[model samples]
Target: MQKVIIFTDGACKGNPGRGGIGYYLISDAGKTLKGSKSYLRTTSSRMELMAAIEALRLLKFPCKVELYTDSRYLADSVNKGWLNTWLASPFFLNRKNEDLWRRLANEMQKHQVSIHWVKGHSEQAQHRLVDRLASRACNSPKPLIDPGYFFKI
Candidate 1:
């Protein structure tokens, strides 16, 4: 199976405001893929989850994956099995970003994935790259609103 290293990041102007998601994927062969998306009404956690969701979605087939992210909410949710608990919950009520979480769960089932946490605003090049990608999305002239998500506040 192919191996991939993925780094994800998200940014938001306000807790419930303009947001963006970014991801950087590196294949075992050294190919690098990067992308970003912006949303007019979203939260940073949503963007972060979206980045991870998109990263896994890009995989053509199941493979070994090492995912890195700065968002503890995302990293911990998966790594600590909180997401599974939520999935096992009755109706998943009161869970934030349930839609994105469902998408993430679907994408994850397609591959072998592991989540890692990193410190944001660090000097790491890949980290900074994703950070820049997400930041740029927030600065786009006309970022489209994400139909998959909305801000509650």
Candidate 2:
């Protein structure tokens, strides 16, 4: 499978407020691709998960993905095996951001994915770039509404 390296970040004005997600992807062939989106109402975790989901969705074929994120929630869920447990447990249905988790779970089935955690606001240029992208996206004049977030309650 083709290997890809992806760096993602999410930012929110408040715990549950205007938010944005960004991802930077580099293919084995050295091609680069990036994406960012702003949400009118959302949480940081949701955007973080969305960043990975959106990046995975962009892949036209199955691949080996090394995904990096600043959110330990996103990384640990997969890296520490919470995701597998959640998928097998009915109790996960009541968890916050279950919708996005399920979407991310489905996306994972399409690729060989490994999630890594990185320190936020660090000196890493990739993290800094995606961080800036997400932060800037939050200021989009006409941000899109996060439907799942609205229905979260």
Candidate 3:
């Protein structure tokens, strides 16, 4: 099976403020496929989840994907299996970032995806690229949208 490597990162000006998500897609042979970054007026967690979701959507074909991100909340929640239990519950009963989590879980069901936790601002080339892209997205003049619909003040 063919493999795709994805590097993702999210940044927020504040814990619950303007944010941006970034990703870099590369083939197993080290060919750069694509790069994307998006801005949002939401929390770091939402951007983190959005980064993964957007990366998956960017893929044109089904392939084995290894997605790397700096957020342990995102990586562990999906990879360590908290998504299933969160989905089974209704009314959002104390769940955090429900909208982003649900969106991520839905997108995850559509592809062969794996999550890897990487150290932020490390020596990884792709990770640095994602950071630069995310910073650009955050500083760009693009209008931001609220991604965390379920998040209360």
TM-score of each: 0.94, 0.97, 0.87
Steric clash pairs (candidate 3): none
Candidate 3: residue 1 Cα off by (Å):
4.0
Predicted structure 3, TM vs. truth: 0.87
* lDDT (tens digit, per residue) of candidate 3 on 1-153: 679988888877776666777888888877775555555567777777888888888777777988999999998888877888788877655687776777787777777889999998999988999988776676657736764544552
lDDT, candidate 1, residue 61?
86
Candidate 1 weakest ten by summed lDDT: 144-153
Candidate RMSDs in order: 1.5, 1.0, 2.1
Model 2 lDDT tens row, 1-153: 999999999988987888998999999999999889999878888889989999899999999999999999999889889998998998988988899999999999999998999999989999999999999999888888988866772
Model 1 lDDT tens row, 1-153:
999999999998887778888899999999999999888877788889988998889999898999999999999999999999999999786677888888999999999999999999889999999999998898777877866554442
- What local distance difference test score does each model get? 0.89, 0.91, 0.78
User: Candidate 1: where are CA atoms >4 Å away?
Assistant: 148-153
**Model 2 superposed RMSD (Cα):** 1.0
For all candidates, what are the clash counts?
A: 0, 0, 0
Instruction: Spell out the clash pairs found in candidate 2.
Output: none
Ranking of predictions according to lDDT:
2, 1, 3
